[model samples]
Structure formats: structure tokens, C-alpha cells
Target: MILLEWILFLFLFLGLVFLMGKYMSSVYLGEDTFFTVIGKPLENLIYKTSGINPAEEMNWKQYGLNLVIFNLLGCLVVFLLQVIQGYLPLNPIHAANVHWDLALNTAISFMTNTNWQSYSGESTLTWLVQMLGLTVQNFLSAATGMAAMVAMLRGFTRKETDKIGNFWVDLTRGTVYILIPLSILFSVFLISQGVLQTFHPYQHFYTMENQSQVLPTGPVASQVAIKQLGSNGGGFFGVNSAHPFENPNGLTNIFEMAAILFLPLALVLSFGYMVGNIKQGLAFLISMLVILLLGTGIVWWAEMLGNPLLIKYGIAHGVSMEGVESRFGVLISSFWGLLTTATSNGSVNSMHDSLMPITTLVYMFNMGVGEVVFGGVGVGIIGMLYYALLVMFLAGLMIGRTPEFLGKKLGPREMYLSVIALLVPPILMLIFAAIALMIPSTVGCMNNSSAHGLSELLYAFLSGAGNNGSAFAGLNTNTLYYNFSLGITMFISRFVTILPALAIGGSLAEKKSIPESSATFPTTGILFIAMLIAVVIIMGSLTFFPVFTMGPLLDHLFMIHGKVY
Candidate 1:
């Protein structure tokens, strides 16, 4: 039955990919789309009202400057909203102002499209704040990524042109045409699936054991839809999708999981459409799937084997069900765990802290590889392209030819930017995590000791730096140190790559297309796909293997000897 569900999901998702990919390409290409009739008027109104000229084009520097300024302003607004939300309307529970550090952290988190939540939603925020602050950021942040991506794509497709697309136009179109429509439909479907969407206060009740329970509810369906579709995984409730109200049953579970990857994967195909090379897109799609499926298989097999220590004690069941929602069982939970981490969507149906050591390694590796296995909406493909550039550079070195991608020459400038963009996240993740471990006070932040504890700490930084906001749930990250440090990490990791990509785009856009020659490396074949996957694995493994050895690998060895950490 689980296998059937998996196959069914693949069928539905692939069908959506081609359809949606073509539509998205049309939207970005400024061609006629189904939404254009309605979207055009609304888009024009936004441009007029905001004083934005839709016809204006921007060089890479102008585009990057505008992009950074816009996101920073958004970060400021969200931070102010959180800190002053108590004075704002719709505070039925009268939730107090958030702490400054957390507010800053969350502001940066959402602005970067890394929706890392240090606080439980129900208790920490009111409905007004949730909608105006977090929900709004969900749409904008994802659109920010999409805008950056489209700009980068334009850089490749056009030659001898200093202009990439206008940031405002791309941002507006992405939100209006792509995110808003899909989110509305997904929200309606979620509401039908019994996910909550109400402004009512928490319901106070007594249980059969005379225990008090508060049924926390809010406008969850709306947030869940965008969170999944936009790859913004900040949950309305504390436990994320694990909360029954956020994801109620198998049907909702499967759909929400599909939603997470839907746009990211489609955008890959969309890249092909934009470049006029369908094979190029398919090569990327296949490479991503190969990595994604391999990771999923590993997690499934390891979790199904159950915990070795529990099996030895004769206290285990059919599968490792610890911290798993009984409704989804091992197969779905394992798949969701891997899938969520595989992309930038951090929503989880199971507790990642309880995953096996090897499973932890895989999850960490997914992020450590920069989450380019169908990564966060627009940015994931950008990350993959960076790897593509790196691979091409290496291929050029071997074949004794100048490397080119989509007719744009990969020169020293492009290679330097790509290397920085690719390597910065892992480097920052390691340095900060190492610093945290050295501080004696930081030990108190962990819920476990030794290797498992190391995994928890490593996972937090990995999630933040990778811009993939999922946690091991074993780390207490609300403290002053974590809030500020992780927030800084999130900000740096996000723009370091984005700015470099933009600069590379600008550089490429200015250069004339180098005609394909006998020395040109073919990027649309099986060999290219194989090399792409190999580069991703080799880069990821080389950077993260030692850390894995110290963390999850050691944890697994310890677990086999009947030692639990």
C-alpha cells in the first residue's frame, strides 16, 4: 500500500510538472498565459501604485542592489510587526511582544526564505501577526527567490546584453501568477481535508483523565498551502505538519509532500523551456531525482530495520515508530523526512531527532549538498546551475576546452563566483558549529550528549546556512546566542550565494555567445547527468564526510553496541 502511494504520487507530480513548467515559462517570458488576462491588470495596478515601471530593465548591479534593499526592508517590517504585534489588532489571546533577538532571527529567516522557527506558533503569535508578518513574508520571500532565479536565467539565454529582467516585474509576476493562484487552490483543498482555518481562540477543555488540554487552532490551511507550495516551511502550529490540524491524514500528507517539490521541480523544466533546450532541463531533473530517490531509499531501509538496540532488547515493533505519527507509519514518515530535507521545505511529519543515525546523515547530507536536489523554489535551481558551472569548469579542464553553459562562456569570473557560492554555506556551517561546540555554555543548549548531541548542533547550523529551515528538534535554539548567531548565519549564507550568482549573471549577460565548437562539452546527455550527480556527491561528501564520521557515523557505531545517546 505504501509502495502504491509512492508510485501514485510520482505519477501525479510528474504530470503536474510538465503542465506547470510550461505555464511558468510563459509567465516569466512575458508571453500570453492563462493568468495574464486577470494578472495583467492587477500587475499593472501594482506597478502604477508602487511607482514601478514594468518596462524598465536593470543591469546586474542595479538588480542586485534593488533586490537586497527590498528584502532588507521586508526584514525590518516583519521584525517590527513581531515586536509590536501586541499593540496591533486581532490579538484575541493578547500575545505579548516577541523578544528582540527572536524577532530579528525570524525576520531574517523569512526574508531569506529560510523559515526557521524558534518559538511555537500558537503560543507566541496572534492571528494578525501570523498573517501580516509571517504569511506575507512566505509569499514575498519565495517570490524573491523566483525573481533572482528568473534574472539569472535571463543572463544565460540572452547574449551581449547588460540587462537581466527587472526585479520588481519578476517578483510581482511570480507572486501574482504562480504562487497566489496555486496557494489559493491548495488552501481550498486543505480546508476540505479538515485542516483548520479559523480566527477563534484556543479551545480549553478537560480530558478523560481530568487533564487540561488546549486545542490550539488558527488560520492554518492558508499558511500550510503557501508554506508547502512556496517552500516556506514555518508552521502555524508548534510541531509543524506533525500537528494534526496542519496535516490530518494520508491524503493531505501525500498532497502536501507533493506540493513541497512541485514548483521547484517544475522550475527545472521551466529552465529548459526558457533556454529552448528541453533535454538540458531533463538532465537536471533526472540528476536531482537520482539523488532524491537514493536518499529516500536509504532512509526507508534504515528506519524499517528498526533500532538495533531496541531489537536486541526485544522491545521493538515492526518499524522504528518512535516520534512518528501513527497515522502515516514508517514509510510515509521516512519519505517525508527525506523529501522535506531534500528540498528547502522544512515541514516534517515525523520527529527528525528520533531518526536513525544513518538517516540523520542522509538528511544532513541533503542540506550539506546545498539542497539542490530540487531545492527551494527558485533558488534550488540556481544552486544546481552553480554546480553545473563548477562541473563544466572541471570538464573543460579535462577536455582541454573553454567551458560554456547554454552558449554563455564560463570564464574565470564565472568560475570564481560559482565556487564561492557553492562553498560558502558549508564553510560557514562548519565554523559556527565548531565555535558553538567549544563554548562550555553551549553544551546546555543540547538535549542529548556525545555523538547524537553533535548531530543536533550540526543539523541546526546546516539547516540555517543551507537556507533549509528544518531542525533535529533536540536543540534549544531560542537562547540569545543561537537566535543571533543563526540569524547572522542565515543572512550571510543566503546573500553570499545570491549576490555571486547575480554578478555571474551580469558578467555572462555582457559577453557575446561563444559559438558551439567541437571542443564544447555537451550538457544534455547521460554523461552530463552522471557527471552532475557525481560532482554534487563528491563535493558534498568531500566537505561533509569528516563531520559525518564524527557525528552520525559514530552514533550509528555506538548504537550497534547497545549504547544509546
Candidate 2:
């Protein structure tokens, strides 16, 4: 029955992804005008407010430099907030100022849209710091990513224009016009659903239920919005939204889930609008949906099955699962698990390390596959484009044709860049894990398969460093080694990918859009979308096969029998 549940959930999740992908293309393809919805209105508003021209473009160098400056400035600000949290007025617990190293790690985590938190939420950060520092970065970082993606899209859409859009303008508009409004509206809805919004520390009282507890409090509604909207996954509390004070109830859970995905889905529409090609954006959207649903199902099914080893040992005697929370339930927790990682939000409700081997692999695979499916709003869209470009490049080679995406010819320079973007993370993950395992600092589950234990540790860093914040959870990750290694991985996971993406965006911007010809491949249609899916899976399978065998694959083999495969 448990196995049956696992199978059913997997199918359902995949079905959802496929349907969403197809639906985005069919229903919203170049349908709404951003100028009407977001652009022209924003233009007038900008002029009236600051007398700045929204229509004017800036050179890529200025744009890139602006991005660097904004990020560096943000990093310093978040770092300072951590140092001063103890003195801040809004701290509920009057939490001590965190150690400098931990503070720095947290600061960079969000600034890069990497949100790889190193501390527990309730115990460590004051509400003031959470709102002003970490939460603030969630919005800024997300906006930054969105701005970068928009810039990239502009590159492909424009002709003979050295400008890839202005960074300051894009940054301002992204927050003022798009992210802030959406965040506020969503934040309000969350507050109404029993998630807290307060200036005071947690109010404590004697409970009839008779257990010692620290009621967590925060300006969660505000932070929750961008965590999802920005796809930055830095949770208000340590366990993420799982802490009752942070998420609270089913409606809030649903709201958070929607928040995480809404922008990503809408951004698909925005992409098509930017490029003036509804079909192209639809194609990308569909591909993202397909991948997201697949991961969701794996998690749902794995949780539903309980743990096979536990079942075999009779450790879990109940009909339903034990490790999972009854409040969230398997269906929702499973959904959140998959959504969080696939989109690069790392918070988990039910512990991922507790899941079955195959289940664990599914989660790891989401990050390993480039994390582009509805990825961190801006990051996901841009990240997937790189793979899309790569697959197109390979297909062109196979057919003895010059490959091009959206009319820009993807020659050797572009393909090489795409290849590096795809390959770098996995190489980094393997090397990082090898070092951790070699040192005694990192350890895994004692009884479960050794391969499984290695996977548990590997998944922790992979998900963290890869910018998908979901973890296997079994591995203890707060050590200096994890603190630093995962921190560095998150940095590279971002800049490495962004550098190539920006460079490609610049290159694509230079080329004129070529009209469809006899040789032209239609990127918007089902055939091309199917090809893109194939490309992602193939790229993932080919690049990570060796390390995968040592981890999830071997774990599965050992699960069937105790001895190493």
C-alpha cells in the first residue's frame, strides 16, 4: 500500500508538471502586454517620481558594474545587521550578536539569491534582523536575479544595441513595480492566515498541553512573500516555514507554496513579452513545469511509502508515515519538498534525510539537473536558458546544421559557455563532498547504507551550494567545514552561472533576430519543448553519472542487500 502511494504520487507530480508546461504555452503565450500591465504604467510612474527615462538603455558594462555595486553594498548591510542584532530593539529573545563568520555566511547566502542559512531561525536571529537584514536581502536578491534575467532576455530581443538595459533602472523597477507590490499583497494574505506580524518578541504563556516551548515570532508575513516570490528560500525560522509561528496553518502553507511559484510562472509570461515571442517564452515555461512536477512526485511518493528499511524492521508500525508531520500531511509536505529544492528554496518540513534512497536521489537530481524549472524567479528562467542553448547546440551538431536559439547563432563561443555553465556545479559538488568525507568533520547515518550516508552529506552541500536550499537533513551541516564549504559553493553556484549567462546575454543582444527559414527549428512548439526536456535529462545523466553511482545509485543497490554493490 505504501509502495502504491509512492507510485501514485510520482505519477501525479509528473502529470502536473507536463500539464502546467503545456498550459503556460497554450493559455498565456504573448497574450498580455507588459507595457500595459507593467511597462508603460511603470514608465509614467518613473518619470513622475524621479524624472528618469524608463525607455532609455544603458551599456552592459554599466549594467554589470551596477549589479556588482548593489550586491556588495547589500552584503555589507546584511553583515552589519547580524553584528548589531543584540542591540536592535525588535529582538524577541534579545538573541546575542551572532559569531562574525556565521553572520558573513548568512549575509552572502541571501545576497546571491543563495539563501543558504547557517543558523536556526527562532534561537539565533532577532526579529529586527530577520526583517531588516535577511528578509530584506530576500527581496533585493530576488529582484537582482529578475533584473539579470530581464537583461538577458533584452539581449536576444534587441538588435545592434550595446545596451542590455540599465541596472539601476531595472533594479528599481523590479522592486517598485513588480516584487514589492506582489510581496505586500501576499504578505497581507499570510498575516490573515494566522502567520504572525509583530514588533514584539514572542509572547510566552503556560500551555494546557503541558510542554515547554518558545513560541516563535517574527515579521514573517513580509519575509514570507519574497522568500517565495524571490525564490530565495531563506526561512524565517530554522526549520523554515515548518516552525509553527512562521507558517502556522494549511492556508498559509498553500499561500507560501503559491508565493514560491507565482512569480516564476508569471515571469514566463514576462519573458515572452520581452522577446516579443509568446511561443519562445511558452516553450521555456512548459519545460520548467514539467521538471518541477517530476521532482514533486518523487518526494510525495517517497514520503508516503514511509521508509522501506523502517517498514522492514517494523520500527514504524502505523498505517501512515511517522517521520512526517501530521499537520502538513504527506501530500503537502511532499509538494513543498519538491518545490523548495527544484526552485532553489531549501527549507524542508518533513526531513529529507529520513526519506528512502530512491526518494533521496530524486531530490538531489533536481539540483543536479541545473535547477532551472521555475527556478529562483530570475535565476531559474536564465539558468534553464543556458541548458536550452546547450541542447540546441548538440542537436545542431547531430543534424549537421548551425544551431540557433531565438535567431542568434550559437557558435563555438556560445556553446562552450553553455557547456561550462552546465558542467561546473557537479564538478564542484563532487570535489566538495570528497573533501568533507576525507575529513572527519562530516559524518552520515550509521546504520543506513554507506552509499546512502554519503548521499545524505552530498545532498546537503549539493542542495545548499547548488542554490537549491532543500537538504537531505540527516547530515549535520552547521560545522565550520559546512559553514565555509557550502558557503563557497553557493557563491560559485551563483556567479559562475550568472557570469556565463550575462556574457551570453551580451552576445545574444549583439545578433539580429533571424526570421524563420527552411533550417529554422521552432523553439515554441511541442517538438522543441520535448527536445529541451531530453536535453536537460541527458546533460544531467552524462555529467553526474560517476558521482551518482557512488551515491544514490549504490545506495539503492545496497538497500536491496546489505553488502556494497
Candidate 3:
């Protein structure tokens, strides 16, 4: 039955991918699609107001500068909003101004499309900040990522041109045409499923036990729509989608999960449409799907196996659903865990900290692989492309041939940038995690000691360094040290990865395509797919194997000995 459900969901998702791919191609091409007609005026108005020339194309340096400057400005605005949110209007709950360090962290977090929250949303931010500051970045940051991706794709599609595309134009078109319309529809659907959408103050209610409760509410549905669709996964409420108000029912749960993956998968097809080859896109999709399905299956099985400690205590088939929300059950929770981390959507339906040890490893591995399992919308596929280049490079060496991808020769500049992009996240994750471990002050953040505690620290750095915002929820990362350190990690991870990707795109764009020959490697075949999978796994294993032994692996061994973290 579970297998059948997976099959059904896969079919539905593939159909959505094809439909959305066509729509997104139209969006990037500035064609008269359904959304374009509605959004064109607004898009133009934005360009005019911002003093951006839609016709202006930029070289890689110009494009990179614009993107960085725009994001820096966004970060500054978001930081100020949090610092002065108390003085701002629409403060029905009168949430106090955020502390400086946390505010700075939050600003960078949202701006980078990392959304790595260091504080609870309801207690820390007012509606105005949520909508104007955080929510606004949700759209822009996601748009920025998608825009970067479009620019990168232009490298493959356009020949003899150093210009990738207009960053501002791509950003505008992505938000106006691709993200907003879909978000609006999803928000309405969520409202119908009992997710809240309002401007009223927190409602006072009595629980069944007659205790006073302040139910936090706001424009949650609006924010949530883009959070999932844009792959910006910060929760409006503290508990995120796990909160009943955010994800109240099974239908809503499914919708949000589908939404998390929707664009990333579709963008793969968009790659095909832009390159004029559907099979090439599907090859990427297949690689991602294989990784995703494997991770999900392993997690689900581990959760269902029942913890050995519980089994010894006479709970038959002792499933470890301790941290899972009762409303969603074990399977959905595990599925969601895999989906959220796999897509770089860190929104959670269950607490990741309480998962079985093997499950935790899968979550870590997903992000460790750069979240290329249908990663974040534009960035996810682009990240995969880097790995594809790496695979090509390695394959080319083994066969004693010059490497090539998408008809562009893989020269040293391209290969070097791709290697740097591929390695930076893992290197940063390890270095930062080690520093955190070696420091006595950071030691107090752990909610558990020994292996599980180590896992929490590793996961935090991994999540931040990968631009994946999910947390183990077992670490008190609200300290000044973490706020700054992880914020830096997020900043470096987001940009360092992006800069190289854009650079490669620019490099590839300048080159002319050569015709395919018998010596040329085929990217769409099973051979390529196998190589792609091998490259991702080998890279992931090689970088993190030592760390894994001390964290999740030890935790699993401890659990089998009837010792639990």
C-alpha cells in the first residue's frame, strides 16, 4: 500500500513537472503565458520603480555584483526591521524588538534563502515584519536563486555571448510570473484546509483541560505558500508546519510536501525546455529521484523497525515515533523529513532530533550531498549540474578524453570553478563543526550528550553550510556565538556556491558548441545516470565519512546496546 502511494505521488508529480516546466520556460522567455498577461504590468512597474533596464544584459561580473549588492541591501533592511519592529505599525501582540545578534542572523538567513531561524517566529516578530521583512525576502531570495539558475542555463543555451541574462529581469519575472501566482493558489488551498490567514491579534482560547492559551495567528498562509514554493522553509509559527494551525490536516500536509518539491522538479524539465532536449532533463530528474527515493525508503524503514530499546521494554514492533506529531503518523513524518531536507526546504512536520539514528544519518547525508536531490528550485538543479561536470571530468580522465558538458568543452577554468563549488560546502561544514566542538562555550548548547549531541552540532553546521535551514531542534542555537558563526556559515555557503555557479555559467556561455562525436560522452543514458549517482555518493562519503562515524554511526551502535540518547 505504501509502495502504491509512492507510485501515485510520483506520477502526479511528474505530470506537474511537465506542465510547470512549459509555464516556466514561457516565463523566462518573456512569452505571453497566462500569468505573464496578468503579471507583466506589475513586473514592468517594479523594473521602472527600481530603475532597472529590462533590456540590459550583464556579463558574469556585472551579474554577480548586482546579485550580491541586492542581497546585501535586503539583509540590511531585514535587520533594521527586526531591530525596530517594535516601533513599526501593526503590532497587535507588540512583540519586542529582536536582539542584535539574532536580528543580524535572521536578516542574513532570509536574505541568503537559508531561512535558518534562531528564534521562534510568533514570540519574536510582529505581522508587519513577517510580511514586509521576512516574507518579502522569501519571494526575492527564492527569485534570486531561480534567476541565478536561469542565468546559468543561458550559458548552455546561448552561444558566443558572454552575457548570461539580466539578473534584475530574471528576478522580477521569477517572482511575478512563476512564484506569486502559484503561491496565491496554494495559499487559498491551505486556507480551505484550515491553515490561518488573518491580521487579527492572537486569540485567547481555553484548552480541553481549561488552561488559558494564546493561539498565535497571523498571515501564516500567505507566507507559507512561498516558503514551500520558493523553497524558503522558515515556519511562521515556532513549531513550523508541525503546528496544527500551519498544517492542520492530511490534505494540507500532502499539499505542502508536494509544494516543496514542485518547483525544483519542474525546473529540471525547464532545463530540458531551455536546452531543447527533454531527455537530458529527465536524466537529471532520474538521478535526483533515485537518491530521494532511496533516502526516503531508508528513513521510513528505520522509523518503522521500532527502536531496539523500546522492543526490549515489550513494545511489539517498537516503532520510534517519539518526536513525530500524532496527527501525521510515522510514515508521513519520515517521508516529510526526507523531503524537507532533500529539497533544502527545512520546514519540518516532525522533530528531526528524535528520529532513529539511521534516519538521522540519511537526513544529514541529503544535505551533505548539497541537497541536489531536487534541491532548492533554481539552485538545486544548478548544484546538480556542478556535480554533473565533476562526473564528466572524472569520466573523461578515466577514458583519456577531454571532458565536455552540453557541448561546451570542460576546460581548466570551468573544471576548477566546478570543483570549488562542489567542495566548499563540505569543507566549511567540517571546519566550522570542529571549531564548535573544540570550544567549551559552545558545548552548553546541546540538549543531549555523547554521540547524539555531536550529531546535533554536526547537523547545525551541515544545515547552515548547505543553505538548508532545518534543525535537529535539540540545540539551543540562540546564543550570540551561534548567531554570528552560523550566520557567517550560511552567508559563505549561499554565495560561495552561487558565485562559482555563475562564473561557470559565464565561462560556458563564451564557448562555442562542438558537434557530438563517437568519442563524446552521452549525458542522457543509463551509463551517465550511474556515473552521476556514483560521483554524488563518493563525494559525500569521502568528505563526511570520518565525521559520520563519530555522530550518527556511533549513535546507532549505542541504541542497539539498549542505550538511548
lDDT of 2 by residue, 1-565 (tens): 9779657855664455444333333222223333236544664676678666656767766677778787888989988998888987877686999887788788878888878766778789887788778888887888788788877777787777777877666666667656777778888888887878876667677778976666766677788777877888877877777777667787677667766766776676667766677777778878877877677676566556554455556656322344466788766776777777777776676666655566667777778886777777778888788888877877787888899888788778787877787778888877888898888646632224478777877787777656877765556677777878887887787777776777777877888777879778777889888988988888777877787788887876775564542
Summarize candidate 1's per-residue lDDT along 39-140 as a digit string, tens digits.
999999999999998899999999999999999999999999999999998887789999999999999999998999999898998898789889999999
User: Model 2, residue 300: what's the lDDT?
Assistant: 60
* Collision count for each candidate, in order: 0, 8, 2
For model 3, residues 1-565, the per-residue Cα lDDT tens digits are: 9789878987987788799998898889877887656798999999999998999999999999999999999999999998999999988888888899999999999998889988899888989899999999999999999988888888888889999989999998998888888999999999999999998778999999999999788999999999999888999987889999999998899889999989988999898888888899999999988998888888877888758888767777887768888889888888898988888889999998888888989999999989999898889988999999998998899999999888888899988888888888788778888888888889889999999999999999889988889998889999887898899989988998888889988989999988889989999999999999999999899998999999999998998887754
Candidate 2 vs. true structure, TM-score: 0.87
Regions of model 3 farther than 4 Å from truth: 1-9, 312-314
Top model number, lDDT: 1
Question: How far does residue 339 in candidate 3 sit from its true spot (Å)?
Answer: 0.8
TM-score of each candidate? 0.98, 0.87, 0.97
| Stretches of model 2 off by over 4 angstroms after superposition | 1-56, 209-212, 296-301, 312-320, 444-449, 557-565
Residue ranges of candidate 1 with Cα displaced over 4 Å: 1-6, 208-210, 316-318
List the pairs of residues colliding in candidate 2: 21-286, 92-201, 109-115, 121-238, 155-509, 346-469, 346-470, 353-472
